[model samples]
Target chain A: MEAPATNNQIPGELGIWLFVAGDLIVFSVFFILIALGQKENADIFVQSRGKLDLWVGVLNTLLLLTASWFVAIAVERCRTGLGATASRYFSLGILCGVGFVANKSLEWGSKITQGINPATNEFFMYFFVFTGIHLLHVLVGIGVLCLLRSVSRSPGLNERRIRTLESGATFWHLVDLLWVVLFALLYLL
Target chain B: MLPFFYMGVFAWSGTFCYRVSLGTWFAWVMLLIYYVVKAIDRVEQEETASAQGQRYALTSCAGLLRNLAHAFGWENELKEKNVDPLFRKSMVFCAWSGLIAIVLFIIGGVILGEMLPPLLRANDPPEEFVRKVNEHLLSIRIGSVFLMLSFALFGPFGAGIAALTRRAEKSPVFSYVQLVFTSCGTLVAVLVAFTWALMAFRPDVYHPTTVQMFADFAYFLAVFSVPVFGGWCVVIALPILLAEEGQECFPRWVGYVNLWAVLLFAPGQLVLFFKEGPFSWHGIVALWIPFVAFFLWILIMCLSMLKAVKADDQVTGP
Candidate 1:
């Protein structure tokens, strides 16, 4: 197999890139919407923000970042035809996703137990709704990575398959990136 | 009665108004009559199939009929051809027929239904609701006619989506699935619209409780029937998402749009839990968001279909 001739070659399918771009736009719009909501009710948002456990947000952020690193390495290994190492890396990446989900569930469970939900107030509404949507994205990203991991383990993985792996990795990274912003916006800010 | 006969004639003729040949009018009329009969039978046989189950079966049957439509569209083409050039062009035209339905629904549902009876936001008292229904009886009657016309267009819209989705497969399985989901969705739309019509038809005659019951029935079905259309989105999006690199029926962005639309539609389920606020049938979360998202979905699909049809036209130049 020949290496890609161009220095600036796109890593994945054009389709995935289009999807990622759309996802980013949607999240950006959500961020803006929440910011406006904060402006309207600063006191409630500030109080609600304080109620959140910042450590959980930080921990989830770190998990996603580490997951991104593992997936990046996995994509490189797949491109280099290192099937076993790539599979191992993908497994680690998936574990990180699981960790993030578990952390999120605990955080939400704590809030619900304290009688906080979307209908609690304007701040909690945005917190729950936006995070709920982001959590969905994270779940889907994990599913995509799982499929890529299995595909990576095949001995007959081809150039096209490597590109597909890279595409899936890009999406996983986007999920992480969005969570980082969400962590800061909802939890830190 | 004379006006209704005129509307029926208009609607019947409207079926043939698509770029479809006049020769097929007889067949289209027969199909319409068959569904009308089926819908009536389903209504009468209330004990047999749950409303949801009946809708599911009806949609599946609609899917089969869409396959038949595809067969007719591609009669002269190769057996393995997924999309006919003619079908691509005509399907867009058929899809635009939905605009007729949209206009009618807005007029009937938004303007008239909401005004006289206030059927959608059912927080009013029995006497108040009954009094309003009686007050503007004529407006409600006129609105129901437009609503009926609107629901009638789902047939063409389902057929159009099935035909368009054929671009993704050599076999007609996905297309058939699209058809079935869309067909059942149409039935739900018609039934809900009919409930509103039934409420308005004899507002003065029926007891207030009976009128309120019809309103509740219509709102619940209209708001909660998300899965019906969501299934249509899923089947259509799967093909586009999985289609080979350049062979995609529409751009990949359209598939993502479908995904987002499906997500937005998910909130409709909240209606069952919350009777007020954003989760209620009239609330922002359940009714408004999903409704807007649906129209946006329709608009984007229309644009994509038209673009595909134009590209096909260029490929098969006159």
Candidate 2:
């Protein structure tokens, strides 16, 4: 996206920022809840932390980060009027998103098959609920990426289309950013 | 005056006698008939005045009928006269329905129903659940009555919103969608109240597990049914967000508010997964966040709708 001709210009419409800010505050609360849970059940949390496959978490993190990167480049391409090229980047971003979803489902499926679920323990409860919510975001982000891809393939990007593109990208980054926190909190920490 | 009399008598009977007497029911029926007659009388007056080419002062009942007529897309019939004030007044009243609902829900569902600190946890034993229900049986029954009344007001509240949305659109598709979802959401809320009342209705006769089942149904109905409520928010937000500049139904921030509500409510779906902790029915994410968000959404939408109505008054003049 073109740099704001003036510093006063926000990256996207002001409305999206309102949504982003509200979402971030709620996620902050989720993180705090996790911290409190970990403090109260340190042993259970630690034990459950070991059972998590670190590599799966690592793969998901990389996939989301790569997707975010592709989306960022796509937004820039759209700004430079490279609509065709931008469409390609959005597709790659979508591919990474699909990969993340597939990997996440596999991880969840294996856990379920092993008789581990949200109700198994407090730690798994947090793990499943929080990650599950984040997974929802990923799914939404992929749909949004598809929209951006189609928009990029269209001719003559107008100011409104660009705004839509920017807002969608911002949302995708939010999904990516949230997953990063989820990966660290649920897995590494 | 009659409506006030009806309310006063009903409230007095409900509080003192714990039951509405036959007299109160007769009075309620009379009030309904009065409303219908008064509404028709005003419409006849308007017809005569217009035939004689004289403007008639808008009465309360006539204003309501006009608002209803407008809501049903009969605007062409009333296009000649200045109906802005009447429409604005009715819209304002409809907007306040949401605020009234929030206040009543707090009193009826949270305070009186003893749901807020949650009377029983999801994993609590059935006997414990029954014991608690028995203890608060009177309050629960009374509260459920208030809750049912409060939740039903959402129908009018949603109608107000859909009406405003209809004005902003060239076609009324989203407004209809909003109305449909509003009915669904309102029904879900009323079902919550009904289920709670059922839980307390015959706790002595029913098995402990039966009471527990009722509690489960109530909580799940209230919290876990996210899509209906979320869809309501989405339709509200989408119209505002997609409206062309200067043609928006609500302010852009209001759309964002609805979007935020949709996100906050999503956690409610997790209540189905966890029986305890923050994801449980009684927990912060599952219950508190969504509950608080819903009222806040109602409050914001109410204020915005009121503001939008007032803005219409200025644009169209007195």
**Which candidate gets the maximum TM-score versus the true structure?**
2
Chain B TM-score in each of the candidates: 0.70, 0.74
Residue B157 shift from truth in candidate 2, angstroms: 0.5
| CA displacement after TM-score superposition, residue A68 of candidate 2 (Å) | 1.4
CA displacement after TM-score superposition, residue B95 of candidate 1 (Å): 2.8
- Superposed on all Cα atoms, model 1 deviates from the true structure by an RMSD in Å of 14.4
| TM-scores, all models, native as reference | 0.69, 0.80
lDDT of 2 by residue, A62-142 (tens): 999999999999999899888888999999999999999999999999999999998788899889888988888899889
Tell me the spans in candidate 1 whose CA falls farther than 4 Å from its real position. Answer: A1-50, A76-84, A113-125, A155-163, B1-93, B102-141, B164-171, B199-219, B244-253, B275-279, B310-316
What is the C-alpha lDDT profile of model 2 across B148-259, one tens digit per residue? 9889999999999999999878778999999999899999999998998999999989999999999999989988988999989999999998887557898776787798
Which is the leading candidate under lDDT?
2
lDDT of 1 by residue, B4-69 (tens): 455556656776443122213323343443354345334434422333363575668867876886
Error of 1 at B233 (Å): 1.1
Q: Which structure among the candidates has the greatest DockQ? A: 2
